[model samples]
Target: MKILTIQQIIKNIENEVVFEAYAEDESFKIKIDEYIPYVCAAIHDGGQMRDDVLEKCSLSTYERWYEEDPHTAEFVGNFPILIQGCDSRFEYDLNRDPDNAIYEEAWGKNVWETPLSESQKQRSLAKHHAFYEVVEALIQKLESKFKKCVVYDIHSYNWKRWDRPVPVFNIGAELVDHQKFGDYVESWRDGLSLIELGDIHNYTAVNDVFYGRGYLLGFITNKFKDTLVLATEVSKIYCDELTGESFPEVINQIKEGFKTAILNHAFEFIKNETSYKVSKQVNILHNELESDLIKIDKQLYSLVKDFELLSVINPINLEFEKKKFLASNYKYEPQFKYNPLNIDPFEFKRKLSNIKVEKINDISIQNMYVDTINAYFDKVDLLANLGTNKFLYNSLRYFGEPSKKDVDNANFVLYCPEFRMEKEGEFNENEVVELFKNATQDYGFQFDIEVSDHIASKALVINSKKKVVIKKGVKFDKRFTKGLIEHEIGVHMVTTMNALKQPLKIFSIGLPVNTLTQEGLAILSEYYSDSINHDRLRELGLRVLAVNMLTSGKSFNETFLTLMEEYKMAPENAFYLTTRVYRGGGFTKDALYLKGLKTILNYIDQGKKLDNLLIGKTSVEYVDTIDELVDRKMINSPQYFTKIFKKHLEKPEINPILQYIFNGIKD
Candidate 1:
């Protein structure tokens, strides 16, 4: 924030320049981010009292604080246009006219031991006058640019003073033209009531605590008939009224809740009044921060280059050890060796935290970036602890362990009569490579298909390199190849290509819980392509049960025996599933495949589109935000959608047993 004279501030407003500054006299502060049609004002938020006035005042600092609204300015600080007073209302109330701006007695208590001099009164009144001048200029600029405007006049009141219970939010609308703006007021009221403040039951009312008779509201309403001023007030539930101590957590919740509510209300107001949609354009600040974040994100991405958990966790002598374990009558646990971590987790997390998300102007976008970064931090921690006992703990944090419901779901699948079915195919690794190569041609993108002995899975899509690696000597079932194409190329590769086309690199990197959504979508693709069989479903369930055993402190041999004997899985299949869960000291990611499939099934059952999820490697949690960005043209829609989704739309029927299994999974 810079210091500038009131004249300079008004000049910037007139020129429609985006700037944030305090008045040269330090009386008030103003910020113009985009010159939007909405303005937020905290006229009574200031607590600074002049030295001369404090010397003559009979009240203590606590007494003055009791009468002032604290943190009111912060509630709407994320807005594009904001004006807040710096001086206490006791010096001169910005909410009142100049005649009675300075109080003789405040809240029924004496204000001064001696009367204030004429000069002192004039000095304080000058600040009051200057505040209105800037407000007038701001409103004038907005009204001229957009034809009409709305001002959110924010304030707070003491709820303890009333004998009856007061609402959490109060809107003063007595002096406004209700016939024209009553709907907007009611809409604002309804939005505020939806805010969740921890355990606090939130309620909002109009004209219940205070009437909209302040001078600021009257001045703006009388001067600009097209501009509506809402005297928005909050009860003192965020702080103690008598003690003056604040609950920072409660204050933070209010700020976050109000941020979304105010933005939505203003958007609706502007659309109704002017038929203009507020375009979400990235300003220079956003661009600069995004550039900085991408650099750090790319560096973090580099640390895990060959660190695909599946490849890294498998012992180099996996084949030799499996034979030995069988020769030893399955008594010895397979001692798995993992690749050493080449990067420092702490150092990388330090770099990741350097990108200050708070600097981003939009609160919702800021939160998205924050969550994305935190997820990356957890990933780094999980990678650094590979092969160590700590790896399991970190794995649990990143990919949570299965719940009892998941175990029950898996048991239900294991007990099904169709679990023992199997199929054989004639296609080898080379044939599958040719099939994958042919699949990529339709998407008009170049992707590599390599038969490698190093990979653990039959075929894995390495999205970072735009390549698919096939485990050497593995046989692919003819019935599974088509669904494999949909799973790998249609979903994974399509989302990867779509992410690369996005303006922000984070989409390509991914959001938190993307694994759950991505894996689920991939398996759903298999189901949609009609290649999913009872055998494949049984494998998914067995993976979930194996993860449950691993997370429940069961050893590798214990989990392997349970799968082979209790679940009646084949010895070789049980060993493969056990290795996947026990790898990296106890990975829980395999559990998400079944969980993800269930989540996607439920999401589709609700009739939501999968196009947004395919836009990048994002989770279901951020679909709404992605949609918002698309509406504002910040990001483009999916360049390539899952082909299987279109095919499913044509023929939406699935096997009844598969539908029944999906229905059995709980939320």
Candidate 2:
């Protein structure tokens, strides 16, 4: 590549000093060849117009009058690039962020002159914005080929006109770490020490001296986070402060200082390390970490991917950011109980995992017995075909006396008894009706009490012919409402009715190992009702992480230790929760909550009704699998749930508003 020396760059600047159109010349062509220098643009005095003296002037007097002046226009056009200082005099200011009060610059007081013309706005943008773009393109080109660029930001200020005490050398401070580009500034400062006839303190560097509009620094930092920007606010001491006239000797000394700083820093950054080397090293580390992390993620996914297989589905797409990956419409989770081989020793490098993994403890089984019984009952209820079975009806008479219409051959309920009392104390029977009321209300059920001294509570059946079974003395708490509403009315009852409505008896025989869909629907119901609070959601989140941890070679004890000891979760909840996710692999249920949330949102996005969802209808099957079912005519409505759900293929276009509400809602 051709290289231009500092003298050549300076000579070209001198030639262009007259601001006339460039002539075709060898020196100009040579100077412009193969490189672009960086320019730090700073706008000064941006605060004054909004707060004080400049506010007395109208917008027209400041913006138009200031730019139209031939001297000011010539000064701007002269520089290869111009950095703006926070100047409140021209427009309320460009240095302050647009979010700042000064952005609209309303306070420039004179209302009549405030409205600016289109031409003036164009002129301002051309002078200010165009400077940055030209410099940026040059820098990018240089960095692309030679792997580095240099920026020299220049400004002039009054020697003693500050609100605060002045420093000798004001090296515009913010967060400039001069050491980043191999300490180029040190050489310039060292070189200046030999030439200075003044005291050492006269060469100090202080920040925020003449802070300009935030744009110059903001734009440059955004593109090259590691690129160096050196802004020097030169004191007007070398000139006649009142008249802006120069003292040749003093100006030369200052110019030498500026030139030295620029040349030294540029040479070091370009020669010390090529941009390609730095970027290459960064890219390699990123790729290696990404590859390792993805392998671990897929391993974790394998454990739960099968959990949804029963529903015959897979995720349409999975997205990964930093370290977390999200998959929607997942079906199955692999079993990872008591397995010690899946854990990755190097996985500790990522912290997002901390939010989702845990270990088991003794109290993990505190709710196990009840859950097991419920599971057993679930199995029994399915075996007897409770929806259409007379035997099941006879066993649940504790609900009350069942009317004849309560049971039909197809298991349809023509009518159900209304037993809820209007007032708590109105009932003559002095039983714990409050508890019974609370428990039944959760399932959208209410029943009348019938008394018999000889009744054995455990064996008693209520409303037998109606197929209503109420367990007597059932205590109530928040869980009762949740369990009944979510499991009974939401899943069991709905599925039963759906079966009765179907011409096929197999639909009522219970869904086949459809745990994922069943749990997904139950959770969705809880979410929609606002019953799934943050704590409940956290538990679900923990399960997700636990499944991932377990499937990736973590042992039960290791997971328990990490979750309860390291993460400090309640031991019991952590243990049992971890087990729930890994139950199939001893780790599968973990993906249900996230997958459930995604499925419910997908359903709504298609503009489908929540009522249809209540009818035990869900979209969980894989796209390919669903297609197979559709082709075989095993499923209908290919245009409804299936079509909308299939739209997940273009998930990137999903509306953010709908997504936020759907995910935020609680069950």
Put down candidate 2 lDDT per residue, 404-497, tens digits, no spaces.
Answer: 2211200111011222213222222223344444534544443443333221111122221112233334332353244334443445345444
Per-residue error for 343 in candidate 1, Å, reads 2.9
Q: What's the C-alpha lDDT at position 178 in model 1?
A: 88
- Tell me the spans in candidate 1 whose CA falls farther than 4 Å from its real position: 1-27, 33-36, 45-68, 86-92, 102-124, 144-148, 160-164, 239-249, 271-317, 350-355, 415-424, 446-451, 465-467, 650-667
Global fold similarity of model 1 (TM-score): 0.85
Worst 10 residues of 2 by lDDT: 357-366
Residue-pair clashes per candidate, as listed? 0, 70
Question: What tens digits encode model 1's per-residue C-alpha lDDT throughout 96-212?
Answer: 999989999878998989999999999999898888888888888888888889899999999999999888999999988889888898988998999889999898999998988
Clashes of 1: 0
Candidate 1 RMSD computed on C-alpha atoms after optimal superposition onto the true structure:
4.3
Top lDDT prediction, candidate number: 1
